[model samples]
Target: MSSTRTTETNGAEPTYKRRRTQRSPSPQYKLDDDDTYEPYISVAQRKQAKLAKLTSWGAGSDKDKANKLKEEEEERQDEEREEERRKERARKERTLLMEAQEVHERKAVEDSKKTETEKAEEHDAEILAAIASRRKLASDLELAQGVQYTEPVKTSWRPPRFIRERTSEQHRRLREKYHIIVEGDDIPPPIENFTDMKVPEPLIKFLKSKRITKPTPIQLQGIPTAFAGRDMIGIAFTGSGKTLAFCLPLVMVALEEESKLPFVRGEGPVGVVLCPSRELATQTYENVLQWTASIAKEGKYPQLNTLLCIGGISMNDQSHVMNKGLHIVVATPGRLIDMLEKKRFTFDHCKYLCMDEADRMIDLGFEDDVRNIMSFFKHQRQTLLFSATMPRKIQDFAQLSLVKPILVNVGRAGAANLDVLQVVEYVKQEAKMVYLLECLQKTPPPVIIFSENKNEVDDIQEYLLLKGVEAVAIHGSKTQEERQYAIKSFKSGAKDVMVASSVASKGLDFNDIQHVIIFSMPKEIEDYVHQIGRTGRSGKTGIATTFVNMNTPEQTLLDLKYLLMEAGQKVPPFLTSIEDPRAAQGGSLTGCPVCGGLGHGISNCPKLEDTQRRQMASHRVSDDRGGY
Candidate 1:
């Protein structure tokens, strides 16, 4: 049995061995079938086989795996670095673009400014050349005519012998005749009529043509002082012929100076008359044209030229007129300063500086501009300051600008005309319109209603129109055309009532205004006087009614009370008895001594407190540091 089992085992073993040989043949196998024999291979052979397989797959031995991992890491790092480089490149590109744009805008603005500066400089140069050529032509014309031109020598002024010889009785009579009060040395006596004022015959004929036989008080005294080349402050009411007073003397001196020296183009004006408003400037210019016409017609002052320099008009036209040469310039301060800045005109040759409504000009914030203009004039030039009221500050300005100025007060300073009957009606703010309507019904046409602001004026005007009352409104906000039309309509009796703001409070001449209704009184007493002065002008009696209310400031109420008492007007008991809240709080009624503003004392002044606190803190720090 063993022999037979052995024989069978040997036979099965041969078959099994043959099968195994057939399945796993040799170490070197086909590359395509290597994976088929991979499990049956030895551990070392399997590793070698794996290495060969990995080599084929681009990952062979451990060193090869490390090299592959290193290559992958290096590739990943390179890719990340490339992405960072791309981002950095994009950021640099954006930065460069932004910097380029900013540089471009700055360059554009710089170029524009440079161009404007160049154009202005070129225009100035052209003007200078034209002036030089005109001067050369004048010199040549004089040489051709065998005439020697010489600058007139300035002589010290002296009072006329006739004025010096006047007796005390004559002076007293002159003062009583015109209600004149003169202060300072060498005050000339007032004249009775235009004929006695020593006015030239031609000007007298011009005056007669206009049917102005009698001289107003301001003209009586102001004309003589101006003719004598003395600085004068003429205080008179509105519509008191103040324009003619300054105009006659200005024309006479301009003509006399022209006769001595030929009119030189671009030499600036010989006389400068500054008005506070464009309308006032226009009115003064019209008077100048009228006064200079007779002389111009007689060919005595053929080169006489009067120019009006005002805003809201063509600057080119004004410059053209100035280029032609101006003997007298009637201008507003703003336009005059603008022209002066452009070098279009100069004040070097200005012999007379006349400021009509001088106080109003200062109140309108032209004080600095006036000072700047005066700086351009020589000390010998005469200054004539005319206003209805002069405040303390305005007097100080006069002292600095004028040389021994003669203060001529025709009437009481800041006093309304006694001829105008003043009445005060105590009414609430809400009831103002109703009371106004009732007053208007009783009063006559040609009435002026003064409001505190533009909106109030507009509201009053609209209300009146709705009530079938023909009314117009004038204010600083109104256009020039609108203001002129409103004034014209009122003057022509087309509009029965004219509502206005403070713009019409000063220097406006309304001779036919029968009543001035103060719908709202102003804060300043001087303004109140001027508003009432508008009526009762030209020797005509008128009425003024004011509405008082709680909204009115305590200081304004007190001032109005004093003004009414001084003018002999009836003051209501409420106004006289109202206690000032500021005074009760132990505060000063006067303005701040440091900043000159109301409602606060110098101790509480913002400018003073801040400066004092900063100085105190600095001193404390210095003491703590042992005076370092």
Candidate 2:
């Protein structure tokens, strides 16, 4: 047969076949292969010719390149299929992860909805395990290994016979009656009568002479604590015999030392009393003298001499007294540190350290000075810190300075003295000065007027004097002599009223202060407490009338309101109407836990700020030393 089969097979368009339902038989596909007329030899020659043509094209034409491109296309298609499979697996994995996250979230919500008891039960085992791990960590850690500790001298004296006579139940009743809150180990029992305490007959006699047959709440507890030679922090309202509580013990300790071995010239000052102000220092010095001078005059003991060390006083005079081996030294921080730094005197034999108006001292930037003074102690001393307000700052300071001190709080420290009738009166901002005259008429002579500013104090004094009111003014700006004169005049009833700044409000116990008029409301509730505390002292009732205007800060008003409510006093409509959101969140009653400022809390406590600033400053010093 010829090589050609049909014209249609010669590359004419193949006609489409229809109407055949049966599949093409395998015999028909085999017949087409066998029908070729060309011999096997001819076919082999044709394949060889085609192979040669392809090789020549590879060298000369681009068809060979096209074949290579076709192979690359097939490879790319295979790779794309593999990539699609990978993407599918990844999507499935993501879906599983999302489902797992949803399950965790649902479990967390279920746990959160559980009651605390239920939750505790659920977590009890894990909690115990966590605690055990923490305990293990603590056991494994050795922190502050380089810190040194020098123990103070332990007290050898026991409570006097009177303190022991009362059963623990009777003592508890006495503490409750006096609202005496004590915190420490081994607290001695409080006494009712002066004779209950173990004192020289002279003190009992002095007490009798002064018509002070019984001790005040602070005196009831504080004297016994000091007598036991224990370090103590004494907190009581103003005029609660706090001075006597510390002063009497100081005298007794000095007397004991003076009798055992008489202090020669340049030898002694068995105790030191630190005060924040010159007035307080002088007052304390006089209080010490009150006991010592009486004892010496009665020929009951050796004479105990005390020196007053304050600024604006001649150092020569102080040195003269120091050279005589003083028995007690009452000093302000500046003068005391000055005397110590100058080596003018020493605390060598001093074992009793008393800080009077301690909160005021710490607040007045005297903390560093006080710390330096503590460093001057040669032995384990008995420290007594007395303050009207027992802020956390004072507590922390007492902790740092004293050893295992007893806390004798007559009442909650920041509380208003129930003895004082606190009256909050709303007045116009412009009419406060005029209303002051009416407030003064509420009580007779021996009145105290507290103003916020020094100039205002002077102005108020002048205004009162012009209105034919006998008024004396005192503040920090005044000369010490002037302040002393004003205090003396007020105490002696020579001045009907004393117009003073807050400087005179603390540690000044004037006789029969009938009323306290607050011409301007103080910003801090603690300050207000102290201002009113100057009156209502020594079992006598007095009234505190405060003039509040719209100019006062809302926080201050809120503090006044809470204070009034707490004291069972009447709250003015203005104060009652004022609302603060913080009151809803544990702010109305507790005030600032750190400093006792009712206007703010721990977040914005001024005392906290001061403490942090001081700490930061100290850390800066360490940072400079490259302690990191």
Candidate 3:
């Protein structure tokens, strides 16, 4: 055997000699005696040779490098496989999350649908109950017919004798306030300068189109005083053109200033009018546009960016408009205060201030906001205050807000329009429904019934509808859309009777209302006046019949007196006889010597009482004192 061997050479190849394996090993490194010669010796030598070969191969040929490269390639494949698994798991999680979200959204939509269905069911039940409640009455059937019931033709819109009462002081005040001493016997119209009336031609034309060419005494006199740059307080009964009287001059002033400025782009609104209620504010805005449409067309007025800032509307939408700047902003006190606090609008440039229904602002507890608004105006701006009645509170407000305002009394405060008849029906509170039905039978169609509470209005509306009457109810609780729909239906003759809360009684002109029935006596005499005023509008002859229960004797008496005064009639002596034991009375106290009630004297009875004063005062102390 040889370590190296050789083979025979061929024609094209060469052969090499090999070491002989049969040769014996050196004696220092001998194999076992029985062992033949071996190519590689001990394990140590094999390992050393292996390492050496590896080292040499690494240093020269790249075959060992190829093996390492192949190992790395296999490891990379394993890592790629792990990444694919991770990505699959992630995809599964994402799919699950999306499916879960979809399920949640579907559940939300189903819940909303269920809520709407439930609401519809409730509304349907209410309607059915209302219909069932009125089936017993024939009047209900008449109401269902939507037929107009015409009131008996009255020779005059006059009050019955019992309700026609007056005090000496009230008479004197009325005479002095309305019939002032004349310098001469001719008794010229109160207007000092008729020619000074500066109503714009456009306004005159507009009024004529509305068939209102002749100004009410208030309009004729108040317009000039206001136009003459005098702060004014115009006190008049409802239906006395109070809105137009204030609106004509204010719009003209805006137009006059607008003309002086170049027709080029400029800021809007030189005047800001405030009304206490949303409907009033909206009505005022409409009247303003109707009066100023000609000027608006002539480009003599700012585009009248009229903004209505009222509740029940999106504040965001309001903010968007306010940020754009308003030429005229008609708003309720609360919403206006809200926007003002947010710095959404400024009144720095407001030049003219007209508080239409100035008394309403006070009654509505908006005095603070009104004062707040006053602080924002320029010191020299003109101010005008208009009210259906001039109570002491309003007089005080005038003192605070107006600077030397010229007093224009169209009719005495608390004076009723002669066109409105005041009628009080004495009945028990529980019998109101029956009495109302009876009155509706005889009282002709198209009447308004007022209730103090929204629930009462709802009850009454339901009752009327059941009795076959086409009536609609409006109150604070009704959605804005519902209230508007009711109002429009009444206006369009789609509905005959409207059962409403206090909102309907204020600043709305419902001329077609032939009669108004107060289903119950109002809480305050002022409210009673406004309630009845709805019928006798625009100098149109209308009647108001109030239902008074025995429990409300004091209110009935006071309301009767107030109503008479508003109608431009004298209060009869009986209304003032509070000391008369036979006179109507209430509130478990000594009779009013003036009104025949223990709570107040007839002569001293304010149209509306102080809220706290009407409450039982220190009853415990009085009881301890053994006072009845």
RMSD of 3: 26.4
Residue 90, model 3: lDDT of: 85
Query: Best by lDDT, which number?
Result: 2
Candidate 3 global TM-score:
0.61
Ranking of candidates on lDDT, top first = 2, 1, 3
Pairs that clash in candidate 2: none
TM-score of each: 0.65, 0.73, 0.61
Candidates ranked by TM-score, best first?
A: 2, 1, 3
Which clashing pairs does model 1 show? none
Which wins on lDDT, candidate 2 or candidate 3? 2
Total clashing pairs for each candidate: 0, 0, 39
Instruction: Give the Å shift of residue 598 in candidate 2.
Output: 4.6
TM-score for candidate 2, please give it: 0.73
Q: Write the per-residue lDDT of candidate 2 for residues 170-189, one digit (tens) a residue.
A: 98898999899888877788
